[model samples]
Target: MTRFGSRIFWCFVTAAMIFSVISAAFPTKAEAITFTPNFTISSEAAVMINLDKDVTVYEKNPNKKMYPASLTKIMTALIVLDNVEDLDNTVYEAPLVVFDELYGQGASSVGIERGEEVTVTDLMYSLLLKSACESAGILAYHVGGESISNFVDMMNEKAKEIGCTGTHFVNPHGLYDPDQYTNAADMALIAQYAVENYPKFVEIATATEYDMQPTNYHEAGWAHIYHTNSMLNRSSSYYYQYAKGIKTGTLDESGRNLITMGSRDGNNYLLVTMGSPMYDADGNAVYLHYEDHKNLYEWAFENFEYKQLLQAGIEITELQVKFGESSDFVRLVTADNYSCMWLSTVDTNRLKETINVDPSLLNDDGTVTAPVAKGQKFGTYTLTLSGEEICTVDLVAQDDVTLSALAYNFDKAKQFTSSIWFKAALIITAVLVILYIIIVAASKKKRKKYRRVKKRRKF
Candidate 1:
């Protein structure tokens, strides 16, 4: 071939290779979309979280302090569950003082006569499902070891432990008190903790109706304790199929409050709404809490989906491997798959992944060394939404990289020779050897001179 033709052919090949690399590095961009829910709600304060990832999906005045109403029983239940070791066997009696307080304050009750005997498990049903103020007092008095106030203190401490910063419990029944208040965000955290640590709490809260058998005081058995949260009652007009157990609260000062968990399409969500209007302008009662919950659930279900961001065994990124036996680069993958809630309508391109490698595992040139084991975690990949990290997974070696013995030894020798200590030692040895030679030579010359002088004297 002619020289010019050969040069042209090679030039075309080189350009094609460069183009291919560029395309691989930066694929075609997808149409960008913004995340902005187009729904409106009437709850004064609200927050929703994706349970699987613990990411906040929606918030409306989440941190604003407001009354939690009967929702306070959630913490009460948690404290009782923790303190009460035996639920089925341990029995508690209602103290007359508890009924006096309930009747005086006009708080709701499940009609427990003074000295009425009931099991701890039955009281839990009454406390959570029926929002029985008297039942809360009974549990508190007994679980608190004769002091309901001490139980209230435990409730606050548990709230703090659950990372509730804006919550303080003045009473276990969630009755109105100037000092008793919580924000939507804090309430969500408390609920999440209960659901995660206590599965029995979920079981009790989700029940539509629980029949309390005849106790010592009443032969006909207490009225069938029905759940106060309408979302869990299938017969209610506002019933939601996905709704799970939580609690409801209401007061003249706090309005209506609800915390509920819903699962659909493999996604579980916890929602908390507080301070909905109790009555409309007509002086008639309003059930805006249910409306707000239903709206939020519908919007979330329609717009959000669980997206698998990283799959196990699929290469995520390539890391340079120094002194590797088979290849100069190693592939990084996730040891387990990572999934997160994402907007179904938004463009997938909006999701960004940021990789952070450990400095200790990287060489001076920003490359990993040989002998990397198959599941070695050397870095992390964080998936983000608008610069906020939604999920993070470990970046692991995709396969084992055997160390090249020759290359490893050569690198070790080169490093040792280049090190300051080795250089200093070498310099010191050379100086010592030179000093010894000079001293020996000088000694030998002196001995020769002495021998010659002696011979002259003899002559």
Candidate 2:
């Protein structure tokens, strides 16, 4: 090939290399709102999270304090399950005063007779499925050492333990009290705790109809109750197939509250809606909480999926190395796998990344020093979709780069010599030497002139 031909080829190659480096340094970025709810949520506060990935997909005033209503019983059931070891074997007798405490207050009940002996299973089912006020009182009275106030204290304590920040329970049965209130986010955490920790909790929460077995008070399936949540019922218009057992809360002040979980095709999500209007402007019954959750679940199930955007141990970029004899640079790869529930319509390659290496690890010239070990974390890169940060993963050394003692020492010596302090020292030393030489030269010249004067005797 001619020299001119080779020159043109090298110029093209240099341009391509520069372009590649620039592309990696500044990635293409697009910001799109991936999580958009299909319908307006009529609830005042709500949160929907993908339980499988633990990601918040939609939220509206999630932390706003609102009345939890009957949803407070979810925490009650959790405390009961925690205290009761043998759910079916242990028995507790109802006190006569317990019946009097719930009498004529417009509280819901399963008609427990005074002084009736009941098992833990019966009370649990009744408290959860039936939303029975007396069962909650009896369970709290026994579990709290016969003190109802003490049981509410236990509920509040458990609430704090499991990360409920804005929740305070005054009663276990969720009777409307001005002091009792919880937000959607805190309630979701409480419900999630019960769903995750207790297996039977889900069984009871999802049961459409629970038969209160022949007890000392009731006989022959006479005391059966259905779940308060309409989403779990197949015959109901608001029935959703993927919806599972969770608690429901409603009160005059609180409007309506619902905490439900949905699972479809290996994806599970938990939703909590609070402070929804029970009746529309026409004064007709409106189930906005249930419908909002149903729409949100369907939107999540249809549009999103888990996609592996980045894989670990794959070379992502190369970093120039100083004092490296074995290799001029080291390769950086992802430290861990980053899989996201990305939009199905978008391609993973379109997702932009912004890489950042630790400033301490990098040299002044934008290169890293040697002595890098494999799997050593050096930096992080954040992935974004439509301008929203999706996830950040650590960047690690792909292979070990041994440090060259000769090169490292040479660089150190060069740095020391070029430093301001060393340069100042050198200037002071040179000035001192020049001054001493001038003084010595003057003294030698004076002595020579004196000798010449002494030898001349005639002058």
Candidate 3:
């Protein structure tokens, strides 16, 4: 081979290397694909939401209204914690009429006898952990000024205040009533509010067992009261390691319901499952509600993770600037850091970001003007997954762009001189001036010729 052949071969190799580098730097847009986990649950309505991010992770029939059963006690307990001044000092006696109504309806009880003296603290434990219908009545009767109906009204009002749109309570015990119903979404929100506001609620709900102290009726004390939520008990087969304090509900008409909060790796999730099948085919009662919760928590903890998608002060994109002092463009970044729960296995390339720029900040030529201040919000970027928007972040200037007086004046002058109207006027003025000079010179020369002709004729 000649020397020229060797040079050509090296040039080809260099060209290939450059092409490879460019391809790696800016890859082609990947097809948008979302990872949807294949998980099945027995509950008719179920929902899971991230407590920290306040975003829905998974949902099915979340807005469908269903019977909440004993889950009503969650709101009942919340109101008691808010209005009741003292939990240990306040004492109330169980009324015979309350027991009569509860017993006739075949409601569950913590064995509160008529005229039995009990403190508010014991009743709360019984109300939440044991799902005692009578304990709820006593608390309501004492705190609601001897009217359980008024207490129910407060529960409904509190539900509305907590952003519950599909919930209404007719009784504190969550007894079956057509008017008393709540959806899975509403119940999850109610549980979230309860856990965030009252720490005692979580303590009582998560307890595996609580001993009721000595009361007037039972001098020795009530037997060891166990939590009705099976997930909290380690001995139970449905026990979940990450299960936290929440409430459960069951009724012949409503089947089984459960509201649960689980924490793993410093992340908390709220789950609600309603209307699970009460019985299997063999005429045996099945705890499908607990099973549903366990499945969801396990799947979520295994697959999802908290991810920081946008960080403050990190450049996201560059915007071209007109009449800028330091540079021709400026970097735009998020105003605040945003983190959300997302599937850990999902490819980050599939996440879509769309920037919506403010028209006032952009010129007609698709460039921004100078004098942009640092931290000024100029646009918004919406992050989406599978065509659904998850979050929106503000796009702010990463650095301050000072106004350049020299550049500004030069731009103004150049704009004026380059205008079509200015050029047309200048051409018209030049043409008029040239025509005047030519006409004046011609007239003077003709006059001179005429004078010379007159002199020749006289000679």
Candidate 4:
């Protein structure tokens, strides 16, 4: 072959190799369509979170405060689990005062009478399975050292400890009180804490029914206390196979509320719905909470899948550097891999990424100091869909950047020379020099005139 032909062949071969490498590193991402649940959300506040991935997929007024109703029992149960050491063996006696207060307020009851003795296990089942407000009172009264008020205080403290900002409890039973309220987001946090910390809570809340056997409070064991959440009952029309144990709440003032967990095909989620319509337009009972939770779960399961939206050590953006060893730009990347359950139909590119560089990262001149470590976190970037936030990832240095001593010293010297104090000193020194020169010139002129006058006199 001719030399010219050989050169062309080699150039084409090299170009092909480079293109292949670039293509492999960044394979083309297939576009996906964004999906929103087609069904209407009747509840005023609702939020659904993926437990395994730790991300929220759906939210409507998640942080708005609303009545939690019996959902407050989840926190009440959490406090009980923490205080009570034995669930079955530690028996408590129902106080006459507790009975009086519950009856006076018309709170739900598990048929406990004054001076009745019951085990902690029985009370836990009653609180969770039976929605037994009286059981809540008994446990609180006992655990709180014969003071229901003190137990309510503990509940508020626990809610704060669990990172619930919008939750405040004036009573343990979750009956309507103007001051006692929580938002869907806050309720989700409380529920997640209970499910993760107390397995016993889940076991009881998930039960279809519990047999309240013969105790001093009850002569007949046939008083079957059933779970208030219909999702757990197989015979109920709202029964969902993926649904598991949690809690529910209802009140004329608060409407209907529900906190439910669903796990299907290894994906687990918690959904909280509050302030749904209690009655249909015709004034009959409405169960929109159940319908809303079930439909949202199915929609999420069908449309969502875990996707790796960001990779570690990949340069996301660059920031100005003042004392860099070689270049004036420092590249930043996320320290850890970022992945979330995203709508399967939505294009990954549609996910909005917003970079928030630290305001302090740059000086007035808009440059950061050098010597940045390989994995130092500089700031963070948040991922969102439409307006809803998914997660925040720490933006870190992609590679180590050594400080240049010479450049740093030079910059400091420049800064010092340009300072106001230095300029003021320089101006004063210049004025002094000018004054000294003028004084010396005046003295010389006077001496010269004196010499001239003396010479004229001699002549």
Q: Going through the candidates in order, what is the number of backbone clashes in each?
A: 1, 5, 0, 3
lDDT of each: 0.82, 0.81, 0.81, 0.80
Steric clash pairs (candidate 3): none
Query: Which run of 10 residues does model 1 get worst, by summed lDDT?
Result: 19-28
Q: Across residues 206-311, which tens digit of lDDT does each residue of candidate 1 receive?
A: 8888888678987765588888988877788989998887889999899889999988888788999999998999999899889888888888888887677667
Q: Which regions of candidate 2 are displaced past 4 Å?
A: 1-34, 345-350, 405-459
Worst 10 residues of 3 by lDDT: 19-28
For all predicted structures, in order, the TM-scores are: 0.66, 0.79, 0.80, 0.71
Off by over 4 Å in 1: 1-36, 309-339, 351-459
lDDT of 1 at 150: 91
TM-score (C-alpha, index-matched) for candidate 2 = 0.79
- TM-score of candidate 4 to 2 decimals: 0.71
For model 4, the local distance difference test gives 0.80
lDDT at position 188, candidate 4: 88
Candidate No. with top TM-score: 3
For model 4, which pairs clash? 32-347, 33-345, 33-346
